[model samples]
Target: MENYMMSGEGEKNSSDVVYLCDEVFDFSTVSSAFFILIFILSVTGNVLLLFVLAIYEDLKNITNLFILNLACSDLVFTVTLPFWAAYYLHHWIFGDFTCKFMTAAYFVGLYSSVILLTAMTVDRFITVVLHNWWSSPVRRRRYAMAACAAAWVISIAASVSDAIKVEVETSWNNLSTCEAPSDGPDIKLGYYLQVSLLFFLPFVIIVFCYSAILKTVLQATNRKRYRTVVVVLCIVAAFFICWGPYNVLLFVMSMYDPRGCNEIERLYIAHSICRILAFFHCCMNPVLYLLSQKLRTHLLQLLHCKCVRIKCKERGTATTVIQNVAFIAQNSAVTLDPHSK
Candidate 1:
């Protein structure tokens, strides 16, 4: 969950005074509980979204494919939440290998999700801005597949820098924490990389795409197109709003030299809360699906079908029980009146 070194130890000032603020705003248990909640919601929501897309929506559509990948990226990110929850409550007991893997996988999920969102924006821009640009459906599908693959590759590569340097270290409190080494130049590299790739680049691309999309939609009288654009804009807006503060704080922390205990403690609290907010973004996408008429319809139809199937199953069970009871009654009657027959 944390790609940078945490202030888990004391720091010395000019007068030989050591400042340790580990006891300040102690909310480890609460944070862990919230993480568990996020895990459950994110898993349930993304899984349901994927199911609906697979059953009720066409994968051949590039937008749906991007959506499917985005959900998968969210799942990949969310699966790490339980481990993070445990780490928050206690320490890293999973060992070095898992620490590396989970950290890498987490970043991979984060990076790919951002990239996929950017790609989705571009796809929308193309569809709306360049409507007349035609190509074979097969070629377009291939291009979409390539974009998905590239996003994963780039994410994995970016994650390696953080994962390889990660190790389990015993902090000043005698608790083992998983974190990147603070000794090397790589200490600051992760923060800068994240700020650029995860936030800055994606923000620029999304802003440009949506601006073009809005201009085109406004000039035309197409309500459907305008509505779809608005929904996507909302999604993009939510993503940035949740992650923007976290990235900004991270960048500041990378360059920050805390002058006192209060400063350090305040930054720690802010960072932890911002991270939780950032993680919550994974769950937001599925909720945002409610804004999309197509996805909403798919979800409703899926629920309706499940309800209908359950009712049919119950009715069939009741009818079989009734038939069995009637057959037994007739047999009893025949046995009791054998001579009458």
Candidate 2:
């Protein structure tokens, strides 16, 4: 049986196992709108975060570096959202090159974000749990830089591996689509790899690191234990909630054989919903820092500086206008007093 690929929430055609589903709902328009909204939010939030970090935070700090890289990763995913939105609204209008490139870029962003998040968790684990394992700031800085570079490289490699399988071709619906080949094995393999690396692996690592950190905090009699635990739980829960369903649904759908129209349609609907939820994750990181005192302080300082500059410019303009008016009045008086002269 032919098997299709699902990338960026768009489906490819699989002819041999075709099942005509009853039109319970038309999700294309809604999906397109959601994608557009997500794109806007992700871009705005991530860009603002990046700007704040660049201007007010030290890049040498591992945490700040990870935050910067994560924002970039979100941006990379977001920049491709419009294209996918267009694909949902219409057929795949763009040709082969964009098809491959966008797919790869999207995957790169996804994988990079997961990697960076995991890296950040590990860094925190080292700082708290290990407590003195790596005492040198310079060494930590070098390692952090290397980690970021390696994350990008690995993400790119994974993305390219699957991206090479994508192509622009006619779907079973007779519309052009960007999709993987009609090979069941390839589709299954890709889904398995994605579920393993993207979801399961990172999720496990993050949980383990956070659990250790929480234990450390508990034993230390720290006053901030409750707050730390809550924050840790929220971080882990948010990641799982956003992406867990999407990956699970994808894995199930890859292995499932829908026997009826209703079953097929239900899967499609669920997949669409879960995929949108996953897309919402691009903006979630910014929310985690919404209550950060340092970030708020930096943002306020930046705004104050901007306001001060504007006021100075206005004062300078007012002074110049006043001087010009005085000069004009004096010149007019001199001209009018010609008889006296």
Candidate 3:
């Protein structure tokens, strides 16, 4: 959890003395633990969701389809967590190839997740507000697929820009750090552009879509309007609550020059906390999606179906006996009727 600041050249400043407080904060320990927890829960939950979606034909709706892809992207990102955790723990042991790959995978997943969430919000908005102009299932499927593909393409391009500029340097303290080379202005420019495009733009889109959807729901005459409002509100609240601080911290760090800051150690501590909170976003969606009433009901029905099949196998003899008894009772009643005679 030690914070090491690099010069714009991507090299550790030899003249810069390591502060006493540097020994206290270990980002490796904190970030490693946080990523480990996120990796486990997000991978497990999203995988289970993917399995559920794949096995059940009826669950193949457009929303669920986008959700399935979202889970896949999350899972892919989560899979790279061990490398990061190792980096935090062993101080970037895997070398430059992995360094680039890890960073690329991370951004790719991050961007893809944002895009998917925005798409899901837009899909909901259309279904709720434009009921008359509904598109066919085929068109919806195509659009969802296209959105997913576009997210990946854009993410890859952003990641490559970072990868090309990023360098791994062993600091004076002998810790290996991966960061952008100092001489390149493109790196800083690229970083800022990424923040704007991947995070800020998508955030605005999500907020706008949800707002419109909320307004429409509020104006509806249906008794279920209140319930719909609550659902959309929960989504909006969660999105902001989990992501807002992280984005703020990123902006703060981007603006903060270690040379200018009076208390670098304090700022680093705050930044680390915000980063950990941001990681919470990875697993939050699965909780929201799985805990939703609609999704829960469907999951229950899926479980119930499995239970019924199991019971039928174990109690086949009892089932046969009950069927035979009913058949006999019906024949006996018909024989006694005068019309039957």
Question: Which predicted model would earn the best lDDT?
Answer: 1
**lDDT of predicted model 1:** 0.83
Candidate 2 global CA lDDT score: 0.78
What digit string (tens of lDDT, one per residue) describes model 2 on residues 1-341?
Answer: 01333333333344466554445466778888999999999898888888889898988777778878988998998888999889878878989899989999988998898887787778778878886898798888888898899999999998997788888888566678887764567667766777797779988998898889878877887546345345445655776799889888867766676665566667778988988898898888777765566777877776688798999999999999999999999999989996857
Error of 2 at 5 (Å): 6.9
Best-first order by TM-score? 1, 2, 3
Q: State the lDDT of candidate 3 residue by residue for 158-269, as single tens digits.
A: 7776676556789787878766654345655766777787778878887887788778877878847445445544654676687688777766765555542335555666
Model 2 TM-score, 2 decimals: 0.82
Backbone clashes for every candidate come to: 0, 0, 6
lDDT of each: 0.83, 0.78, 0.69
- Candidate 1 ranges with C-alpha deviation above 4 Å: 3-18, 171-174, 183-186, 310-341
Q: Top model by TM-score, which number?
A: 1
